[model samples]
Target: MATDSASACIRQTERFGAHNYQPLPVVIASGQGAWVLDVEGRRYLDCLAAYSALNFGHRHPALVAAAHAQLDRLTLTSRAFHNDRLGEFMERLATLAGTQMVLPMNTGAEAVESAIKVARTWGYRVKGVPTDRARIIVAANNFHGRTTTIVGFSSDPGARDGFGPFTPGFDTVLYGDAEALAAAITPETVAVLIEPIQGEAGVILPPEGYLAQVRRLTAEHGVLFIADEIQSGLGRTGATFECDNAGVRPDLYLLGKALGGGIVPVSAVVGESSVLGVLRPGEHGSTFGGNPLAAAVGIAVVDLLETGEYQSRARELGAVLGRRLEELVGAGVQSVRVRGMWAGVDIDPDLATGHRVCELLAERGVLAKETHGSTIRLAPPLVITAEEIDWAIDQLREVLAELS
Candidate 1:
């Protein structure tokens, strides 16, 4: 139950803030490592990790120190003037993504929009497509961003409804079907944008060899393959990129979420010079894209991934997570899909909804979130211990038993 302070805060927020999100009735006060303290002084393990933005956990020392140092030195100078931090951030991020260029942005949605503009411009300038005639192929059930253009091609009605007169120039195809994707391509197609592992769509993974086929088809058709790694990249999938795990490379990588070490909002479009080079100055930019504070934290994030420690943690820990979740398949959980440290567990509709199960989990001191009606996603911080993983699953098991 919520205390007076927590209830009062929730009431005030509901009264003033927009009703966009249906957050759990928990008011977080502060956090350290994998646990957060609520207003009532109750602690809970953070399982969602701010939708994977807090991969290193809250207030990670290196990231916090980087932010503190940058805050004391400088913050934003905008693109009108160069700050001392942007160059190193861009260089380090490019090296980390194994690409030649970086087009920084402030959010995942901004990065997606920026990549769209870049792909269209590239098609018109280099691919020889007619002006305003370039088309991009996207997967169904894909969740790239909430922006108008991004949602314009979305297959989910919840994301597309009430946002209409949607943008054209996008074709929809089945996510893991190579034949459908191939058939959707045309001479006017400029790029094929997709998520390597669909994080929002219940952590759905493609069929085996699907990514390799995408690479081959794009190279053969001269179409740019843009991977929206906002939720799936940056060591979330047990590798620097899910593409790396699959041994396939894309022409452009749309990255965000954990890139700022959860210290600031930092995102970017990483790609080769020939593709990202299409954007000239004044063509497309963000005011706070590469600000000094964001850059400092981004650089620190890159440094963390360079060690390969976090990726190894995800791989080893993910196996344990998968095994525990699979045990519940017939015990209230209808199915489960896991990759790296991320999982999508589908609750049996006869038992309860995912939201109700998460609420019960929260009551038991573990915090998680539901993606759809019956699917809940689990993405703990990479720093989480094996013991903590077991405890979180234990809480889930108890919740399922109670529901049963």
Candidate 2:
């Protein structure tokens, strides 16, 4: 519990754990409402927010209460039997998404995998696609999840290398190019899976109308449009869903990250009955997918979003974030792409790498993350205040100034 304990903890982790992730040096011990305390009790603004998993901020009171309440009651009843909480959770989630059915899962990757399975099954059973020939078209630089099948289609070599012999039946297309997508769709194509905003690819935003074009093309071609909203949904992008911003409705929604309110790992594939109804009872399932605890936490999350306050907060504070980041364009910052409360800031390589900038910012009590080399991603919790946003920006400015 001492401040110096962080170094010991880091050393222990490095010694025992896999070296898959290179995290920032700071060791977070506790968090509450957009801020985290280190073992030393140093508080830092949580700009990354667990890659938007903590969109409601760390350990939100409502979510915590729900988790606590569930702990005292039923927790897990596997799919073999029924749990009272699962039906309500699914119904509420389906209603929130305007979908007729919900398939709950434990992680974002599982949700994505479920969507893929549903799409492929629908293709074979409903679309009359020949068996074992169904192909799913994925966008270039898309980051869906890290499972073998998910990473098999990844354009990023870091994610794909040595992970193969990978899953087949996937075709890669240039992202944001409707013409390319159309050309790639063959008679055997089952679905087009993409992220509305490519969160891991430096929060990349597609060209305007790209999503709408995808919807039109998928509808016309009789292919399912799967939107990976794990990172961009749940008020992170100033909307309940990023597809809403583009005025498009994907056939299936792959939702996770924020759905659990940072209390547990919860995800779901929400879609119309016509699409999701393809699965027979024993086709697929998870042990902890819709446990009472996860459902309870997820219900709390849906309740919070029902008020529309979080989305509005993201929109209003996002403007402030945009203005402050835009001002840095010519000052040791190369460029910035901002949508809602999310931003990807490209650092001037002549001055510093995104990792260096993040390190400097962390030293100044603002924690962020770097992606794709020189680009740093900023996604503060919606609960973050205007003053906190300004403060984080000030730290970034200072980091840039010092680097310059």
Candidate 3:
């Protein structure tokens, strides 16, 4: 239950704001590391990490300092005149992603939209696909973003309902099925866009060797394999990219979420010059895309990943998280899937819904969210310690026992 202070804030916001999201009743005031303070002064372990946007945890010192220093100097130049920070930020980010070019944007959805345009344009300019007929293949149940174009390609009805007439020329295929993907490809297919690990679809991991097969199939068909790493990239997956773990490189890397170090909204489509170079000036751009403030924070974020400290933490602590979660499979969890520090635990539907489990976890001072009605995802910040992971899992265990 929410206290008067928290209830007032929730009520005021719901009364005025749009009802697009049904967030838990707790109102957070401040955060540091893996913990947050609610309006009523209660503390909770943040298991969702703002859906992996807070991978570095909240207000990281280096990121905050970088933001402050940038604030004292320059902010935005609207991409009209080149900003000093843009080039360096792009260069470093490209180097980190192992790509030749970076097209900066402000959100994951924009990055997806931008990549779609790039792939389509490349098909026309380089691949010699007939104009306006280029098609991109996407996996079912994918959640790239809420953009109309992105939603149009999504298999989820809730996201697509009443949103379209959606943009056309997208082919849908079953995820983790190489045969379906191969069958979907044609001369008009320009790119294969997929999340390396499906985050919003209950943190689903593809079948073993599935990513490599996608790479192989796309290469044989001369289609660009665009990995939407917006949620699975950075240090959250215990590797710079989830693709890296599979030893398969995609043609384009769509990055966001943690790229801003939880400071600002930063996203980009990273690819070789052959692909991204197809975009001419004024064709696609964002005014606030490569602003100085975002660049400074992005540079700091790259600096952090360069050290590989967070990735190591995620790998080491993720093992601990996976083991604890597996113990509950027979208790109330029907199944569990884990990769690095990310997990999706499917609560037994007969026991309770994922939403109810999350509400109980919140009451016990742990924060988590559900997806697809019955699965709860755990993606605590990479900064979270082993002890904190134990405590959070303990809370879930108790909650399951109570439900049982």
Rate residue 130 of model 3 by lDDT.
98
- TM per candidate comes to 0.99, 0.99, 0.99
lDDT of 3 by residue, 1-404 (tens): 89999899998999999999999989999999999999878999999998999999999999999999999999999999999999999999999988899999999999999999999999999999998999999999999999999999989999999999999999999989999999999999999999999999999999999999999999998999999999999988889999999999999999999999888999999989989999888999999999999999999999999999988988999999999999998999999999999999999999999999999999999999999998999999998999999999999999999998
Report every candidate's CA lDDT.
0.94, 0.94, 0.95
| lDDT for position 32 in model 3 | 96
Q: Which stretches of candidate 3 lie over 4 Å from their true place?
A: none
Candidate that scores best on lDDT: 3
Any idea what lDDT model 2 has?
0.94
Residues 262-343 of candidate 1 have per-residue lDDT tens digits of 8899999999999988878899887899999999999999999999999999999999999999999999999999999999
lDDT of 2 at 102: 95
Q: RMSD of each candidate?
A: 0.6, 1.2, 0.6
Give the TM-score comparing model 1 with the true structure, all chains together: 0.99
Query: Could you tell me the TM-score of candidate 2?
Result: 0.99
